[model samples]
Target: MTPPPGWYPDPQAPHLERWWDGAVWTEHLRAPEVPGPPQPAGGVSGRAKAVALTSAAVVLVAAIVTGVAVLGEDDDGGGPATGALPTSVPSTDLPTPTPTRTTSEPPADPDAVPDVVVDELNGITLPLPDGWTPPKNVPEDDVVMTTDDGTYECPAGVGLCRHGLVLTRTVTENDEKSPETLAEQDIPDAADAAYDRDTLDRRLYGGIESHRTVKSGPVAVAGRAGYFVRWRVKTADGPGGYVQSLAFPSSVGSESPVIVRFVFDAGPDGPPLADMDRITKGIRSIGDADTGGGVGSSIGPTG
Candidate 1:
């Protein structure tokens, strides 16, 4: 960026701010007006200008793509402690808002939801993976955590993510299937929810555990209390992926022994969770085994 026709060069800024000496635009200092951008070079037609602008836009788009790709492999996406891995879920204080029957976070069609699986605890269907070989019954004091995409503290196929951590919890719930009327216990919070990586089920990726809450319209889950959710957001960085979960609480607080969920970090399905267009096209909520819900679902809200 050369300065056009300066007056004189300032003694103090000898090598720097030079000034136009005089007539022939000398390097002398004076009260000269700031020079504007140079005019376009002479061209035969205006096509060159248009082409230049288009090229600039293309370059910007390309740069974004490259940045994302590079960051995607950066493990933690350069976030806090989560740092490219999932963390542990500790017993802690969670949102204590009253649960409502809202469809703000309704589970989607089972077919559309990937990574989410269902299992049977007693007779009621529990949400688990086909391959998750648990100890059969989860303990009451057992710690819980959930994630979006990250290494699973548990086995890969289970609710645990094999990629990154998220902002949800996973509890075996002492093998007790949730009754229609839950006694309603207090949940944990961030400080209590925080757990070490070792305590978590390390999947392919490493990170922490998470928990979330919602409040909205209700959806029936196999004759039980249920709600339709707008979206499910999880982090590849374990629990406490607090950003999006605040959107709803009731739709997410289910006591099922196992709950299946899909994790999303990037793409159109991230941040506040996948949009309705993508979620409806993917998530599926199964009913009883007698119904299409199968061993995978306890009949949560359907799309």
Candidate 2:
């Protein structure tokens, strides 16, 4: 018959004890308790008394041995060490170690955001979203950037289907007129013409219906002072929408400022104005250039 589950002296080892985990002898083992010093034998008359004291001593030692074995029990629920431990030696107390915090930084997410487009012209730079791309050729004075793969559009085959977002920059010499005055005068004219490129290429044609100013105020772009104007335009070909334009003087005192316009015709779902503002703020002037602000140019009323 198999022995019951318990700690027992190992038959294979001379002095070490092993745990018989009910079915098998486990690897857990401990050295047997060290034998104590021999006691001196008493005289013949005192022999009887000596024997009685010896019996009591054995009982006391047995109790101590059992306690030492139980104390060796593993906290992990594993079997206790098999051998008897010396009762005379004290157990060492150890401090529990605290866990450490990791300081390594996490890697950047590759697919978290879309790519960006940077447009540089006339020494000024503008950062646009990924969809915006440069056309093969636009008007010499104006740098036009458009989004070709945009999901937003008007019905196909219509008279004025929106071709995604359109950003146009018109660099003109300072004509002494304030930015607000120039925008107020130019926007109405462009809207009155219906933004017809063939009829008025340089001036924006707002269509037959007309374009009205929605809001206008002072603003700053890339740390340069500027004026911002919002417009509402309607056309016969498609639903009417809003246009945002920002014009700022490139240099102080008699220097012409650049006019940047953002036009998108969305019927109900309009462009996110906050995001547009962020894009506008990204505008930076790399350096000054001779933009050749000539008379009757697109920058002023003459064009």
By TM-score, the best candidate is 2
Which residue ranges in model 2 land beyond 4 Å of their true spot? 1-18, 21-119, 127-153, 156-166, 172-177, 188-208, 251-255, 287-303
Model 2 lDDT at residue 146: 56
User: Could you give candidate 1's per-residue lDDT for residues 193-286 as a string of tens digits?
Assistant: 2221333433322333443444223333433343333232343443323222111112233544323233333333223443322322223334
Error of 1 at 76 (Å): 85
Q: For candidate 1, which ten residues in a row score worst on lDDT?
A: 242-251
Stretches of candidate 1 exceeding 4 Å from the true structure:
1-118, 122-217, 227-303
Per-residue lDDT tens digits of candidate 2, residues 16-88?
A: 4566677655667664443434556653346655765676567446645654554555434244343433323
Taking every candidate in turn, the Cα RMSD to the unseen true structure, in Å, is 26.3, 15.3
- State the lDDT at 141 in candidate 2: 35
